[model samples]
Target: MNDFLLYEKTGGVVILTMNRPEQRNALSSVEICEEFEDRCRSIERDPSVNALIITGAGPVFCAGGDIKKMRDRSGFAPAKTVIDTRDSYRNSIHRIPKALYNLEVPTIAAVNGAAIGAGLDLACMCDMRISATHAVFAESFIKLGIVPGDGGAWFLPRIVGYSMACEMALTGVQIDAEEARRIGLVSRVVDGAALMEQALELARRIDAMPGRTLRLTKRLLRDSGQLSLDHHLEMAGAFQTISHETEDHREALAAVFEKRAPSFSNR
Candidate 1:
């Protein structure tokens, strides 16, 4: 829907490409933030969307915030005071994580290159991450004398444990794809040329599931982190009750007994 972000659909899978190659797909402006929020809402409303893959347009995944804009205190909603700055972040850049978090579809971050500062946090926002061999990542906001005002602190620690998150946040050191994989930041790392192919393949595999149940499963997994065992089991039981009543669930069982591939209506 916007120039900075490209939306493409192949069957039930959607791909969102950060299309600002000239700017290294930096999360620099309010427009990019709006684009991400809008597209995510659209995807959520569309029942046909079962999976999402997010990646950058060019060699760089995302350079984080625009340093020039930051230096001048001019991007997103430019503010002249502390209160105004807080409001600006809440109104602008913060929308991406909130939107992505609320999105029902399973999400994947296909990291093609550098993911620095807020960029690294953006990848952490997704359910799964796959990286290209040439990709590098860092919690580099400390290097700029700015903390992650976009909720990176919350996400980074959740994705990579507290101690590793502390090291990355405090030192602002960059790590390669293999290091990311070893640290459980990315599940897989492949050649740069095959990144999208690998991501799409993974997305398509997930897309083959029954749609309603897939969304419910994702919601359960996400909410489980904040829930006690008893509360999570109660919620899971309620969701499973709904799943069992769907036509797709019946078809799945029938297919297993018949020894045939199941075709989900995604009900």
Candidate 2:
């Protein structure tokens, strides 16, 4: 609800914009993390929302943690004690990944500019990523003499593989949009002006699908990474059974036979 995070819904696509342009939309305070968790809860409760797009408001997508706050020994950095630092990460920034990973809706990250440290991990949390040509990314925690405390270790390797993730995390070097695409960090890169346009177009395509099926598919994919082949197939079968019983499934089949566009209720 705060101005730091802006939420807008169009049809089944929801846009969540980080609005702190002045600080380059840094995750500088507890408020930003809390607002993000609250918004995820709202999105989960809203049955009408089938897809989400996350982006930043200004030139930089996110500068990651607030360097200024770190310098002052305030905010999420430089806790008074080691235990306090651990608690800070657990209670604050960790909530974003927990909420987003469990979110049923399809999510996209439109990286408009710089995505450093935790910002890079944030994009990795989404189902897909599209970047502006001017956008840059870095696993920059090493440069600050800290490890990735915000799930970058978990998210980065899955997207860019172990070697690349290790290189990025160890070196803390920046990669441009084209390099990001080459390494499979981003699916595509476009002009800065076209960033949102491309992201919304992708969101609209996903929004046109049945909401229940979309959620189920995302769940299956998430589980697939952890489950054995046999177990995954069994899970897929169970979900398929449920999918077949949905009214939207029947409508889709009927439309196919009738040679017409399917009218999905998103049931």
Candidate 3:
């Protein structure tokens, strides 16, 4: 892990902390994006890690892009042409969402404070979101005279519906944690001091499940949005067949009959 990103694991849950409190954990530098992608890949290969929780180091969850870098064009790159700028986004910032979207394990965004612009989209990339009472969210790209260049356009609508997503994106207004929860953007809200505890508690519940089952279930959910009902049912059938053959499945069945907890080895 780099200085800007901190990685720690306890049992089946891995916590990823954006460590740049000074910058409000802004996803501005190429290094931050690269490190994020690398960590996603690492987690994908680790079966022992059944869940992930993303949070920031300080009060601010993330402030999105670095304004100074955008003005100076130093954080991205020196791009003289439109094509250069386009490629910079494709090869740099875009990688974070692509990598995250493909990650096999379940992920939770523990929004500690401000999640603005691309930062809010970053939280949306996760499978679930839980916010602190002090946290705020916004699809704030319009405020900067830009659009959702970092997949916010694609993600926000799915979480908060088309009308609400449009309202936020078009107006670039900030919403409190309670509003976020009410709109279904975040699943729950907790006291600022209990944010991580709440997130970790949820992570542990998810992590206790069979690892392969969790991955397959997540994949099914991801594809369900795009798949027809017939196709989705077929895919689910195939996955269910494969899952039934796993030792973890047998253990789960045995535990049910024995009235005991299942000990899953992630098999």
Candidate 4:
């Protein structure tokens, strides 16, 4: 059977693609959500992979949750069907971002085209985003008479500031890659065909860096966002103490003093 989400391995990076191009790759079918989440979970099975890139096949990223499919139900209440779809989308995450959130690695979203509704929320899951110049983001839920589900409201405010987040949320605006970059929605915007190339280059650069420290830093940053300064310092200090004892840390410090590149084996 063809995979709804395609998985590819590149060095320390895992690339995941939404494989349904026929419907602009929308997660409208219930089966697609299950399949997509399965692929995401499978990618996390590899220990050597340190980062991930999520994109979609075809010219469009995802057309939100499959609005057409959900609405086509013969007699189901429209609102109830939407709520069901929202639940499915929430469950489809496979606890992956929470893993990515704590995975001591990074994730990048190479938004190649329009990222709508749940699609836009999916992009927000990553730690970084690099999109095609023509990519668009739509917070389209309000137009459908439903609220943004799947963490869009949560991630947008965190990354772009409350004021900007308020504007995006209230307007349900479709932002272009340039505007996305301007308001911090994405980190970089490249030509359509070059999005993945640039993302891998970035993943390679990140993968080449120290893995242990990156993990520790990820934890530190997560804590910093919620913990008080003293609490965060205490957390970082604990991590630093544990980190300094690692052989990789010793090698990195020694290499820094000796004026040579540090060879890290994640020891």
Which ranges in model 2 have alpha carbons more than 4 Å from their true place?
none
Residues 118-205 of candidate 3 have per-residue lDDT tens digits of: 8999999999999999899999989888889989899899999999999999999999999999999999999999999999999999
lDDT digits (tens) for residues 94-185 of candidate 1 = 99999999999999999999999989999999999999999999999889888988889988888899999999999999999999999999
lDDT of 2 by residue, 1-267 (tens): 567888899999999999999989999877788898999999998888999999999899988998888888898856589889888888889999998999999999999999999999999999999999999999999999999999999989989999999999999999999999999999999999989999999999998889999999999998788899999999999999999999999999999999998988977
Off-target runs (Cα >4 Å) in candidate 4 are 29-45, 73-102
* Predicted structure 1, TM vs. truth: 0.98
lDDT score at residue 56, model 1, on the 0-100 scale:
96
TM-score per candidate: 0.98, 0.98, 0.98, 0.86
Error of model 1, residue 176, in angstroms: 0.4
Question: lDDT at 267 for candidate 3?
Answer: 86
Candidates in order have lDDT scores of 0.93, 0.92, 0.93, 0.76
Off by over 4 Å in 3: none
RMSD to the hidden true structure, all candidates: 0.9, 1.0, 0.9, 3.1
TM-score of 4: 0.86
Q: How close is candidate 3 to the true structure, as a TM-score?
A: 0.98
